[model samples]
Each structure stands twice: as C-alpha cells, then as structure tokens.
Target: EGYGLTEASPVTHCNPIYGRRKPCIGIPLPDTEARIVDLETGEKELPVGEIGELAVRGPQVMSGYWNMPEETEMVLKPDGWLLTGDIAKMDEDGYFYIVDRKKEMILSGGYNIYPREIEEVLYAHPKVKEVAAVGVPDEYKGEVPKVFIVLKEGETATEEEIIAYCRENLAKYKVPKYVEFRKELPKTMVGKILRRVLAEEERKKMAEAG
Candidate 1:
C-alpha cells in the first residue's frame, strides 16, 4: 500500500517488501516525515493511534499549485508540511490507516461524523454488499448522515434492521438518519465509491421536493 497526492508528486508512503499490514497504506518513504495533526487546528500532532489529518514533508512534495497562492496556503504550511486532506491514524509499528477525508466529515447536531466509520459498520452486515454514506442537509441539524446500500446476492434486509445494526455498533449521533437501497453504489473507474455523487443527488432530491 502507498499514500500520495498530486501535490506530492506521487508516492509518499508504502509498505516495505518484507513487512506489510492489511488495510494499511504503509510507512513513510525515504526522506519523508509524516505526522498526524489535529483536524481543527492543524497545528498540534496527535499521539500514536489517534486519528487526525496526515501531514507530510519531503523533497518529493510540490512547492505549491501553479499560481494558486490562496489555495496553496490552505494546504502547504510555511513549515514545509503538506496537509493531506485525508484523516488517518498511525499505529506504533508505523503503519498508517486512513479513516476518512477531512472535507467529507459531516457536522450534524453539533456532532462530527465520519462517513467511513458508519460505512465500516454497515459493511459488516451479512446482507450488505456495498455501501456509501454521505451528509444530507437537514432543516433541524444543518446536516444529517444518510447511507445508500446494495445488498449481497440473494440477501435481504429492512431499513429498520440495517439502522438497528448500526445502532448496536455506533454512537447515537453517528447513526444515519436515512437508509436507501440502491441497485449498486456509484463508483469510480478504479472501483472507489463516490460518496460526493450520492450527496449531490440527495441535495437535488431535497430541492425538488421543496
């Protein structure tokens, strides 16, 4: 596994040929230094196993986007660390696990909910084949998390049953307000789920209803 962004000029982290961990993006590459910084402040580094933004400093890292100073300042810190929008946690063994995306975090009822966290819970259901969770605008809470799911072949489940499964494994505030069944979740060419597409669809549906 490797971790990198366009601004980073490509690969930054990858598991060594000799050692690898499942679900880990791997250790920082040579000449690269990585840290998990607080999501809100983006200043203080968090301890091991704590989830936060993954920041990296290396020669391979880009100086800034061409001619986009304001946007550059948002991600490129003066101290030389590039703030990757990915939220992640590093274990003691130095392996990194991506939790979610900072911009994708849902703020609902004064709670910060990571869609990946809910997706993780939902994916464990025997009937679930695929799922994508997104934040939808809610009149009372500003935004509430909702999920779209695709069931496994020959499996079936009710909305209440799925919600109850999540409730058992997740905090109350983290529970999705709406559950939708889809023939299939949207995906990118590489087979990555496109949660933003679902979120935008929900917004349009709400607008049409209004």
Candidate 2:
C-alpha cells in the first residue's frame, strides 16, 4: 500500500486511492524525490526498469539519528538522499516495485539472485503456506539459495517435489539447492519474515559442522 522507513517520517510513497497498481508502491509524494541508484556505490542513478537501491530526498526525511552520526552518515548521503537499502525498480509509468533487500541478495556462481523471486514461486504451490529463501554458504558458488517452507495445514510435500517444481519455473542458478520444512518461520511482530535470522542460523550450522 505504501513504502517508507522510520527515517522518512515513516511514509514516502503510497498508492493512489484509485487506479493504483497491485504490488506497486506508487509514485513519490509531492516534494519527495526518489530514484534508483547503483547498488554497489549508491551514486550512479540507474535508468528506468533497472533494479537498484532506492534513494529518497524530501522534507519528511530525517536529518540524522540521535547521537549516532556514524550510523546516520552511512545511510544519509552528503546531498541529503537517504539510501533505503531496498532493491527496487521503477516502471515507465513511474510506479516503483520492490524486488528485495540489497543485503539479502544471493550471489551464486556469479549470478545475482533475489530471494523474493524464489519465494514467490514457492508461495504459488498449493501445499506451501509460507516460504523464505535464504543464501547459505556454498564452497563452489560462494553462496547458494536454500528455501525454508511452511506447508499448509493438513498438507504434505517433499523436498524433491518442491525442487522439481522450482526447476520447472526458475533458472538453474536460481533454483534452490536445499530445502527445510518448518512449522513456522521466524517473524517480526508485524509479520515480516526474518530472513537474516534464518541466514545466521545456517552460518552457525556450518561453523558447528566444520
């Protein structure tokens, strides 16, 4: 419905009351400027349809975090733009769509993979109630996607079946190499899945096994 962060007074973009596109965050509000920038440096402004970090500058944007100049400086650019740390793209119509978080992106075999893309495919499976795709340590590829799925009540599915389904819908590199079925996923009070927590758990498991 809307897109923003606490640093931006919590609201920056919202869908129009009418003619709003599904899953799009809509155009920037009055006096607010938003752009897609290079994910690496967050400096080069990307062209439309290019996936990059979303940055915003407006009156509602926060000046700085309380007594945390270093933390503030990391996000707030010298020119006043605040990097939202979200991987996003803008359509020709100016509607913005979030692909995923920059930090959550998986780099496997030199290919960039967004977890949301994988999660969306799994969510379409009738037996899957919820799913999260996270990058786990991989010796050959540096990192590979591993999916954690929560099956619908009274439904049963196997890892092989899920993998086969993904293989049909996704590229070879984007297909998850491992799967873990869970009763429920770690979530925030607002119901956002905690991919970072899952990723940390995988890292710990690798360390323990080694």
Clashing pairs in 1: none
* CA deviation > 4 Å runs, candidate 2: 18-22
* Model 2, C-alpha of 47: deviation from truth (Å): 1.0
Please give the CA lDDT of all the candidate structures.
0.91, 0.94
RMSD (Cα, Å) of model 1: 1.5
Candidate 2 global CA lDDT score? 0.94
Q: Please give the range of 10 consecutive residues that has the lowest summed lDDT in model 1.
A: 15-24
Compared with the true structure, what per-residue lDDT tens digits does model 2 show for residues 1-210? 899898998789988887756678888988999999998899999999999999999999999999999999889999999999899999988889999999999999998999999999999899999999999999999999999999999999999999999999999999999999999999999999999999999999999999
TM-score of each: 0.93, 0.94
Off by over 4 Å in 1: 19-22
Q: Which candidate number has the best TM-score?
A: 2
